[model samples]
Target: MEYIHGRTGDQILGSTSIPAERKGVYQYMATAIQKLLRIPIPPELPPPPPPSALNNDVFRLVMFLDTEAPRIYQNADQLELHLNTIFITAHDICFTELLYLHMGSIYEQLKGLSNEPMVFCYGDIHPGNFIINDDGHITIIDFSETSILPSSFARYAIVSTSKLSRG
Candidate 1:
C-alpha cells in the first residue's frame, strides 16, 4: 500500500472557510472523476478469497472495517447541504441551461441505464473519499465499491438525487 500525505477534500473545504473555495472543491472533484475514468481497467484481477478464509474471525474483521471506515457524510442532511453547495457553485461557473441539459441527459440515461453502454466507475464518490495531495492534486481513494455500470450512472448518481430541477 502506498502512503498519501495530505488532507481529504472535506478537510480542505472545511479549513478554507471561504464559500468560493467550495466551488473549487467541485472542480477538483470533477478533475478527480475525469482522471479516474481515464484509468485503464486491469485485464485480469485476482479472485475473491475462499470461504474457508472468510470464517467467523475474518467476517468480524471485515465488518469492523466496513463500519469504522470514514465516510463523506453521515446522513441525508449533510448530503443535501453538500449537493446544494456544489450545485450553487456549478451554476456560478457555467451556463444554467447547459448544466440543466447535461443533468437531464444523466437523468434520462439513469432511467434506462440497464440498456446503456457500461464503464468502470468508482461506485462511490464523496468528499471524504477524495484526497487532496500535498502537491495540491485530487486523488480518489477507496475501491471497495468499484464496479462496471452504465457510463452515465456516475454523472446521474452525482447530481440526480439533488433538488436541482430539469428546467
Candidate 2:
C-alpha cells in the first residue's frame, strides 16, 4: 500500500491541532469501517442470513453464534446467558460508544443489540489503523489479518487494545 499522506484517526483524535470529536470524523470512521469489512474474506462466511421465511434478522444471528462463538452453549437458556453476557459486553464497550464502560452493569446499558452479523473485518482495529487523511476522508489500514469472522472477535480486539490505551 502506498504511504497515505495524512494523520491517522488516532493522532487527530488525540491532543493536536484538531479536536478529538467531530461529526465529519465520526462519519468518515463509520464509512471507513464499512469499507474495511467489505474486504475479501479469506474463508466463506457461514450461511448468509436466511432469506425469506418467517426468519427475522435475529434468528439468523443466533444461528451463526451457536455455531462459531465459544462452544459452551448447550441448551437455549445456556446460549442466551452466554450471548447476553459476553457478546453484549464486548459490543457495548467496543462498537456503540467507541469507549468501553468500566463500571457496573455496563452490559445492561446495551440490552437488545447482540445480533450483529458476521462480516469481513480488519481482524485488528486500533487507534492507529483508522486513518484520517488531510482531505477529511478515513481509511482502515492493516489488511494482514482481514477476513470474515464473528464481529465479536473484532470487537474483542478493540476492547483489548483500548484497555491498553487507557492504561
Candidate 3:
C-alpha cells in the first residue's frame, strides 16, 4: 500500500485498499483492548494511588494532548508552537498545585522511577485504523500500535479521546 501526504501535509497511508488484511488486524486489536479494559488493573503494576493521586490521571492526560497535538494538526508548524506553550503553561500550573498537596512523598516515589520509568499505554488506538460499527461502538484495528510506558499511560488516561498525530 502506497502512502502519501494528507491534507495536513502528513504522510499517511490514507487508503490501503486492502480491507481484508486490515480488517483482520483490526479485529484482533479490538478483542485485545476489550480484554485489557475489562481486566482489573494488576496490583503490582503501578504504585498505589494516594488521595492526591486522583488528579494524576488528569495530569497525565494533559501531557498526552501536548505530545499528540503536533501530529494531528493540519499546519504542524503553526500548531506546534501553540501546543508547546500550552503544555509548558499547563505543566507549570499542574506542578504548582501539586507541590502543595504533600507531594514530597509522591515526588520521592517517582524520582527513582525516572531512571526506570514505568508507564501503561494502549499504544496504537488511532482513528484511521479504527472503526465504529452499527452498534455505535468503536473498534481498534491494530495491535502493533499499542504500548505502555509510565509517562505515556499517564498521558493516555488523561487524553483518552485524543487522535494520534497521523504520519
Candidate 4:
C-alpha cells in the first residue's frame, strides 16, 4: 500500500463542530464517489464477485483492527456509541434514521433493476475511507470492498437524499 500523507475526512470533521463545513466535506465526498461510480465496467471481465467475498474481507479487517470488536457492541447503546465515533460524526441526530430509510428505499429500487446495466462501485464510501491531500483533493483509499452493482444502486449510494445537478 502506498503511504498517504494527508488527513482523513473523519479527523477533519472531528476537529470542528460546524455543520456547514462538515456538510461541505460530505458534498465533496459525494462528488468524488459519484465520479468513481461513473467508470464503466469492462465487458470482457469475469462474473462479478460474490457479495460474501466483500463481507468476509470487511469482517476480517474489522476483527484485526479491534480484537474485542465483536464483543464491544452487545446492545443498541454501545452500537450507537460506536457508530457515532466512527461513522456519523458530522450528521445530525435525524441523519441516521434518514440514512436507514434511504438505504431501504434504495434496496427496493435496485430490486426492480436487477436486469439493468451494472457499474463499478466502491461498495463502501464512508468518511474514513477517504483522504484529503495537501492539495485539497479527495482520494478514495480502500478498494477491498469494490464490486459491480446496478448503476442506480451505485448512484444512490453516493448521492443518498441529495439531487445531483446535471450541467
Candidate 5:
C-alpha cells in the first residue's frame, strides 16, 4: 500500500459542519466514482467475489449476535434466528428484515445490472475511504475490495452496501 499524502474526507469535515463544504466533498466523491464507473468494459472479466455473508441469515445472525451481544457466543448460547428482507430472504422464516435490506438490495440491484457495460470500482467509496488532495481533487483509497462490474451495478458496490452508517 502506497502512502497517500492528503487529508481524508473525514478530516475535512471535522467538527464544524458547513453546508457548502460538505456538498463540495460529496461532489468530489461522486466525480471520482463517476470517473471509475466510465472505464471501458474488460474483454474477459473474472467472476466477482462471493456475495457478503450478510446475504445468509444463519451467517448474519451469527454475525449480529457476535456484534450486538458477544455474551451469547462467550457462554455458548444456542439460539435459532432468521433474517428476512423485502428484497431477499436470508433464511426460511426470516426475522431481521431491516438488516437484510442492506445486503439484499445490493444483490438484487446487482443482478438486475448484470448485462450492462462493466466499469472499474474501488468497491469502497465512503468518505473515510477517500482522500482530499491539496488541489481540491478527491483520491479514492482502500483498493482491497476493488472490483470490475457492470456500470449499473457499480453504485451498489461502492456505497450503501456495507454496515456503515447503520447502528
Candidate 6:
C-alpha cells in the first residue's frame, strides 16, 4: 500500500514538474521525495531497447522481475510471497461465470496463435501495475500469477488476444 503511493507513474513522471534550471535539484529531490515517503528506489536499470518481438518483451519483463526478487526477498522461498491476498474459496457465481467466458475467449485466441513463435507470460500486464522509467526501462510487478508456459506466438502473445483481455 505504501509503495504504491511513491511509484505511481504520476510520481516519477512528475519529477519533470521541478523547474528545468533545477534538474540537479530535482534529481536529489526525487530521491528525497521517495525517501521522505519511505519508498525504496527501484532497481537501477539500463535503457530499454526498442520494441521487439513479444517473446523478447515477456522475457525482458521476467528478467527484470527476477533481478528485483532477490533484493526484495531475503530468501528463495520468500519470493513466492504475496503483498495483497484474497482467494475465492467459494467463488461468486457471477464472477466465476464472467471469468469463464473471458477464459474461453482467451483460450480460443491463444490456440490460434499457438503455432507461432512467442514467449510465455502470466495473463496480466497492465502499465499501471508495471513501472517504466524515462530510460525506457520497464519492470513487471504483481507477480501473484506469473509463469513461463509454452507458446509459439512470440514467447508471450502480443497485444492481439491477451491484449484485448487486458482492456
Clashing pairs for model 2 are none
Q: How high is the CA lDDT of each candidate model? A: 0.48, 0.48, 0.37, 0.52, 0.48, 0.33
Over the stretch 49-88, how does candidate 4's per-residue lDDT look in tens digits?
3332112222211111331223333323343344444434
lDDT of 1 by residue, 93-150 (tens): 2223223444463222112333444445554566778887767777788766554433
lDDT assessment of candidate 3: 0.37
TM-score of 3: 0.29
Measured against the true structure, the TM-scores of the candidates, in listed sequence, are: 0.50, 0.44, 0.29, 0.53, 0.55, 0.27
**By descending TM-score, how would the candidates be arranged?**
5, 4, 1, 2, 3, 6
Query: What are the RMSD figures for all models against the true structure?
Result: 12.9, 9.7, 14.3, 11.4, 9.8, 15.2
Q: Per-residue lDDT tens digits of candidate 5, residues 1-167? A: 68788888778777348989877777888898888777665454345522222212111221233323222211101221212232244432222333233336333311223344545645555678779888886778766555443343354444343445442
Q: Rank the candidates by lDDT, best first.
A: 4, 1, 5, 2, 3, 6
In candidate 5, what residue range of length 10 has the lowest lDDT sum?
73-82
Give a tens-digit lDDT track for model 3, residues 45-94: 45653111122222213333353322333222333344345535554433
**For model 3, where is the 10-residue window of minimal lDDT?**
4-13
Least lDDT summed over 10 consecutive residues: which range in candidate 1?
52-61
Candidate 2 lDDT by residue in tens digits, 12-119? 666455544644555676677767556554332356622211122222221233323334332233443554565455663333332233222433433322354445
lDDT of 6: 0.33
Specify the highest-TM-score model's number: 5
Q: Which residues of candidate 5, in runs, are more than 4 Å off?
A: 45-114, 158-167
Rate residue 94 of model 5 by lDDT: 20
Off by over 4 Å in 3: 1-38, 43-120, 151-167
**Best candidate (score: lDDT):** 4
Enumerate clash totals for all models, in the order shown: 0, 0, 13, 0, 0, 14
